[model samples]
Target: MFGPFRLTSPLSGGLLWKIPWRMSRPQKARQRARLRHVDKVVSIVDQALAKKGTTTAAVERWKAEMPVEQEMLPRDKYTIFDRKEKKYRKGIHKLPKWTRVSQRLNPPGY
Candidate 1:
């Protein structure tokens, strides 16, 4: 029953490749908003440092200005538990106290 069967060639056109899709407009906008907030915080910190002329005061002010709800957390909330040493130690210090003392001794270091 293969009478009058005709062979057809495959269609040729532009390449067809799968591409990864991207976020919708609303999702993109929300992401941009979050980035903007981060940028604002950075700018605020930078401006405070520049205007205060002293890192310690700027940091103290920043801490004082933080929301009270954040302050409710235990002082050692971020402290690391030294299992071997059996003590709670501060995690990486953002601005160690020694740095301030050293800067006082050598203002140029600041």
Candidate 2:
């Protein structure tokens, strides 16, 4: 004979079941913040793209014209990730160390 297994225990009640159903408060808050930031960035890019004919060349030109100090400018300004290897052909220019440091520390979305 198997021992009696009661479904309702004093310590394990509705609260125990509810715990899994509830989202972690901190995780939810972080997700909301990330969504907001992504939306803002998308809006800014969209606004910039909307001004002219919205062509690839126009976007590339606009990106190239941006200041190097700006976060968005480095990739385009330095052309480090360029597939054509035009700018960094001689390997004189390199990404700053701080970029890697920040990337490791902050990460994408917490």
Q: Please provide, for model 2 over 1-110, each residue's C-alpha lDDT reduced to its tens digit, 9 standing for 90 to 100.
A: 23555555534555453223223556445434443454465557767777864846644554464322334322332223423555422111233452222121111231
List the RMSD of every prediction in angstroms.
22.3, 19.1
Predicted candidate 1 versus true structure: per-residue lDDT over 11-55, tens digit per residue: 234654332223345643553444345446756786777797756
Candidate 2's C-alpha runs over 4 A off are: 1-22, 55-110
Full-model lDDT, candidate 2? 0.39
